[model samples]
Target chain A: AQSVTQPDIHITVSEGASLELRCNYSYGATPYLFWYVQSPGQGLQLLLKYFSGDTLVQGIKGFEAEFKRSQSSFNLRKPSVHWSDAAEYFCAVVFNQAGTALIFGKGTTLSVSS
Target chain B: DARVTQTPRHKVTEMGQEVTMRCQPILGHNTVFWYRQTMMQGLELLAYFRNRAPLDDSGMPKDRFSAEMPDATLATLKIQPSEPRDSAVYFCASGPGRTNGETQYFGPGTRLLVL
Candidate 1:
């Protein structure tokens, strides 16, 4: 079974500070990893995804995630935090088996402060 | 831009009532998925269809929940005899193909409150 784990339940960061959200996964093969963000009472927006090629993938809103194959981790990072970046972040893995959906983590709630 | 759309942005119903949530996938997407989100469960895939065929539904509760795709553009999820436990947000997503690694576009979701 493929599953994702987001270690932080909640994180607070000051504006302009660097941010890193940790995510680890368990999968049988080279997994398709994704990072998604959801605002309060809104649907999820894809931040970035890692399918193949380079380990570091860039996404919308200046977000990026690095896929570490050996460690089974795909952590999201931002150079500078903004108040608008406050949202819930989720880590998901797409299992390659048939009839499978993206398995998501419990999510990490980020609070940005000025 | 093409995006997934869901209907009944919000729904309030009593226990034992039936609730239906609808979704319209992107025009050319070939796969549709239904998911449930709650504080405890996070996001869970309830069911999914590939090319209008039921491919998987193992995550859904068989007794009260059902999902179907009547056409390429439409997918529906129905809950009969709704319970308070079923009070959560339902999301619909679609992807370009049935491949496992396909990127999915999600709908805004329908919030359901069962009293």
Candidate 2:
């Protein structure tokens, strides 16, 4: 079975500091990887996604994720953390045959400290 | 901006009651998906419809949970005899055909609490 793992349950970072959230997956092929962020009391928003070719993909809100086939990882990073960046981040992969749905990880709660 | 819309932002009902949630996808989107988010389960895809046709519903409990798209603009998820365990934030997402590496725009979500 395919599964996504986000090692950190919660992470705290100071404002203006660089941040990185780790994600690892178990799949036979190079799956369609995505990173979504959910603010408190809100729906998920796409931060970035990686399908092929590009190892580093940039997304909205100055977020970026790098896809590493060797490690089966797609990690999200931000150059500088903002208070608004405090949210739950989820890493997901496409597993279904039709490839319309997603299998999401348990997510990592990021806390920005001033 | 065109976005998916879900009705009844919050619903609190007693156990054994029937609960219905509605979603309206973006005008031209061809695929609609239902997902449940819980603290324990994270997020799970309950079902999805393509071109208003049912595709895979394996993630949903067939007995109590049912999903439907009565027409192009509306999609619904209903739970008969709702239970406390069914309490969670349900989200509806839609995209163009096949996803095509396209992003699935999610609605605000309907928060359900079964007492």
Candidate 3:
């Protein structure tokens, strides 16, 4: 079975500041990782995904995540966050087997302040 | 841009009532998925379909929950005698293919509240 852990439950950052949200996963083989964001009362939107290739993957709204196999982590990061970037972010991992489902973390709520 | 669409953006019903949520996937996507989101559970995949065939539904409660894709564009999740515990935001997602790794586009979701 695969599982995901997000260490931070809530984080607050000032506008234009750098931000990083930690995510760790437990899976047997190379895992397919993803980061998603959700606003209040809205469905989740995919921020980024990592299947293979480059360790650092860029995503929409100035978001990016790095896949660190050694650390079993796919932490989401942004160099400078805007006020509109505040939302709940979830990290998920998919098992490589057929007919597999994605296992998600508890999610981290980001609060951006000016 | 193509996107997934879900019906009944909000549903409020008493316990023991039948609740049905509908989803229309992207025109060319081959895989559709149903997920439930709650404060405690986050986002959990309740069921998945590929090529209009049920692939996995282990996350779904077998007794009261059922999911089906009668055709390529349509997917439905029905709950008979829905309980208060079943109240959550249900999301429908669609992906391009059945590969292990694919980015899924999600619908706005149906918020179900069972009183």
True contacts kept of 2: 0.64
Clash count in backbone of candidate 2: 0
Q: Residue A70 CA error for candidate 1 (Å)?
A: 1.3
Interface CA RMSD of each prediction in angstroms: 1.5, 1.7, 1.6
Q: Using DockQ as the measure, what is the rank order of every candidate, best first?
A: 1, 3, 2
For each candidate, report its DockQ versus the true two-chain complex. 0.73, 0.68, 0.70
How much does candidate 2 score in TM-score? 0.97
Q: Is 1 or 3 the stronger prediction by lDDT?
A: 1
Candidate 2 lDDT over residue span B13-90, tens digit each? 999999999999999998999999999898999999899998889999999999999999999999998999999999
lDDT of 2: 0.93
- By the DockQ metric, which is better: model 2 or model 3? 3
Error of 1 at B97 (Å): 0.4
The DockQ leader among the candidates is 1
lDDT for each residue of candidate 3 in B1-115, tens digit (9 for 90 to 100): 8889999999999999999999999999999999999887888999998898888898999999999998998999999989999999999999989576787889999999999
TM-score of each: 0.97, 0.97, 0.97
TM-score of 1: 0.97
Please tell me which model should have the higher TM-score, number 2 or number 3. Answer: 2
Better of 1 and 3 by TM-score: 1
